[model samples]
Target: MHATTGVGGGLSDEQRIESAAHGLLRDLGRLTRALLRAGEFGLTRSEVSVLDALAAAPLRVTELAAHAGMVQPRVTALLQKLEDRELVTRRRCTTDRRAVETSLTPAGRLLLDQGRQRMATALLSALHTTPIDDCERVVCAAQKSVATLAEAMEPEAT
Candidate 1:
């Protein structure tokens, strides 16, 4: 098997860091999709995201769209599918009669729980087979990197 490396043999610190970040992002996307499929929930990634957001609290379609990073029309369509499956319900917003609020049903909550358990089992199984020291190092690095990025991304105080 050929090893994948940065464009050039020698790289600066910034280049190496960028390369590693790209590879990590690619692997994370692949692994997340695999884990989602392993759950066998028959839900698309977008659908799962919608469910996850609703698990927090009921929201209007526009709010759900923002939470899911999707457009309102797309959220409405997904909600239709979820409603057909009896996983979610839409009702007129109590505070705003003009707006509709969507919430997860008991079935949706149960499905989400099962999916989470499956994902946890898969992650635990993978972690069990890996070296503990390496896992700890990587986890620590990831945490630090995420925290740094988040801090950098925060808006400046006026």
Candidate 2:
């Protein structure tokens, strides 16, 4: 039986890699949407993206926009909404008075944690039919893949 994936059907290495990448992106979008279905965590995808971006460290509005792949104005609006809910806090930067730094509040962190747990539980239950060894491999590969993408996006330190 022929496998549906293009990663190893006697194609060129580059072609195989590209096909796998396309598949990964397509499935990733579906998975992301599934995780946030109907605002499962009382947070919009954009809002969650912003929160996740801030998880690493506080960021200026421009930095946040870059991280979220959004325009500054839209990100500013989201920040305003988050601030109103006390899920995020923005303050003038100590090093640069003109810049505003945004950080997640404890509430925001807790919400994120809860959302992660929910998704984990849901995926675990849904994967009951899959073999345990396959699940373990997928989980490990996903973590490494995510880290690889994160590193690719980072700029070189000065």
Candidate 3:
């Protein structure tokens, strides 16, 4: 019996890992979309990304655009929508009067909290449904994998 031969036929370790990674990514995407659809205060993926970035701190339009990986004009349009909802506010940068800075309002923070809570609830439900031992092992392995990737990807210190 070759290492790659099984009921499903030959699959190298790399092939198995790649298949698992793709499945995980697809499931995550599905979960996110489902959660957004089920939630009362729904937000588009781009909106959520922008809000997550702004959660760190207020930033100028250019900085926010970079953080959200969006073009300035698109970000500006999104900001306008957020402003209309009173979820964010924009003001002239004191130090750089020519630049406009945007920040999450209390409402925005509340929405972010709600979104996080929904994610936590979904994750907890999954954990509860799975066997405890299996969950623990999988989670531990995932954490180690993430850490390994982060370390490998980290830039060299000056």
Of the candidates shown, which would achieve the greatest TM-score relative to the real structure?
2
Q: Clashes in candidate 2: how many?
A: 0
Question: What residue runs in model 3 are displaced by over 4 Å at the alpha carbon?
Answer: 1-28, 38-40, 131-158
Q: Positional deviation of 77 in candidate 3, in angstroms? A: 0.5
Alpha carbon deviation, residue 34, candidate 2 (Å): 1.2
lDDT per residue for candidate 3 within 43-137, as digits (tens), equals: 77888778888898898989888777789999999999988998899999999899999999999989988987776566556789787778778
- How many Å off is the CA of 140 in candidate 1? 8.5
Per-candidate Cα lDDT values, in order, are: 0.83, 0.84, 0.78
Q: Please give the lDDT score for candidate 2.
A: 0.84
Per-residue lDDT, model 3, residue 26, is: 76
TM-score of the candidate numbered 3? 0.68
Instruction: Name the lDDT of candidate 1.
Output: 0.83
Answer with 1 or 3, whichever has the higher TM-score.
Answer: 1
Model 3: lDDT to the true structure: 0.78
Q: Model 2, 71-113: lDDT tens per residue?
A: 9999999999999999999999999999999999999888887
In model 2, where is the ten-residue run with the lowest total lDDT?
1-10
Badly placed stretches (over 4 Å) of model 1 are 1-17, 130-158
Pairs in clash, predicted candidate 3: none
Question: Ranking under TM-score, best-scoring first?
Answer: 2, 1, 3
Q: Which lDDT value does model 3 have at 109?
A: 89
Model 1 — which ten-residue stretch has the worst lDDT? Answer: 149-158
If scored against the real structure, what TM-score would every candidate get? 0.74, 0.80, 0.68
Count of clashes, each model? 0, 0, 0
